[model samples]
Target: METQARLIVDVARLDEDGERYQGELSLALLDLGASEVFAPKGALAYDLFAQALGTELLVRGTLSLPLNCICVRCGGEFQKVVQDRDFVTSIEISEATDFLDLTDEVREAIILDLPSYPVCSDTCKGLCMTCGKNLNKEICACQKAGSDRRWATLEGL
Candidate 1:
């Protein structure tokens, strides 16, 4: 199915009282076109659970994405699988339009859940301030100096 068609629900097929529809959606359906948080390699999987309530559609589900992120401190590359299980949103459909597309909603949910500052690990030592070397991988000579010239004047106080 076409990307847009895959994310659309035919409201005419659902009962007015409320009916549940379950399905799996590919990441391509929720593609944001371009994003910093989404990786280009791994496939994202979305487990969808939607309910029809009269003219409204209630969507709730989980989505998993393998993300390629950069360490905020060390500037190193790393991969992490992120999941959003609390995804929930609602859309209104009119009698004239029997379809509701969830592409934008799903895309927003994934983006909102991304970490503001991503790190490779909890103990990442970051970089040596003086020589700008990754401290996590090796010790630097500047570290032994143990004193910063910027703070030299403070010693007198």
Candidate 2:
């Protein structure tokens, strides 16, 4: 069955077992802002269950989003998927709280799950320090020259 997505829960309408919410959140709404190193390729997708637990609302789900990242080692652009499989949170609810928005929770989960230093591959060769060349793509002239300046005198002797 095609279930309609629910981003905002109707607190008053929630049954004893609660309701399931599944949808894609727009990247624009997140206001993640411009990032030099990385950016969201698309919207953040979520599948969650929201239920009432006494005075609190319990939310649990998974979040995943494709990101275009600049490889930290080679400075090359690459695409990666960031996922939060164990997303869980509890929000205190009240009589006046008729609606519970899940946007904030989703945003926080993604931000916390983002990788600090992203790489294109585990075996990335990085870049040539002297000529600023991507070692993974092509070798630099510096590599053909010598290993180090300190070894130049020893080789001549």
Candidate 3:
């Protein structure tokens, strides 16, 4: 089922302690383009608290989302949960600010927490450069070629 992207709160209902919010938002709200490298497998969950402090409104929370990613090194697929324990955002508010919406902030928190280049494991051997083989699975039959042929004379010295 589809989920809501907006998190609107009425400032009038808030007291000195502020108000707490907990809900799930649509993964599409993140605006991540279609790509096989990475994608969200489920909705993003958030537990947040909002308070009005003088002229500024503060929002702090935790966010969690499951992601399906392809490892950059070996091209293997893996699932990982991206979480941000201290998601915080502040907006300037005035007397005229009766309501606050934090739809974009929630989206940014999840995206920023994701790894730029995901890997299945830190010790992955990755693909062979010349033979086009997965090194982690088995040894390649091709001989190990030197990095540069021009440096052959330097090896004797």
lDDT string for model 3 (1-157, tens) is: 6645577777766777898989887766666553667888988888999999998889898999888999888898999888999999989988888888787788877778877788888998888887878888876765244434436767867
Local accuracy by lDDT, each model: 0.72, 0.85, 0.81
Winner of 2 and 3 under TM-score: 2
Those runs of model 1 whose alpha carbons end farther than 4 Å from true positions after fitting are 1-5, 15-40, 94-97, 147-157
lDDT of 2 by residue, 14-96 (tens): 98898888889887777665477788898889888899989999989889988999999999999999988899999999888
**TM-score, predicted candidate 2 vs. hidden true structure:** 0.81
Candidate 3 structure lDDT: 0.81
Q: Deviation in angstroms for 71 in model 1?
A: 1.1
The CA lDDT at 89 in model 3 is 91
Alpha-carbon runs more than 4 Å astray in model 3? 1-5, 142-157
The most accurate candidate by lDDT is 2
Q: What is the TM-score of each candidate against the true structure?
A: 0.70, 0.81, 0.79
Per-residue lDDT of model 1, residues 20-127, tens digit only:
544445557666453553353455567777777666678787876777888888989898877898888888766776778776776777777777688899999999
Q: Kindly report which residue pairs in candidate 1 clash with one another.
A: none
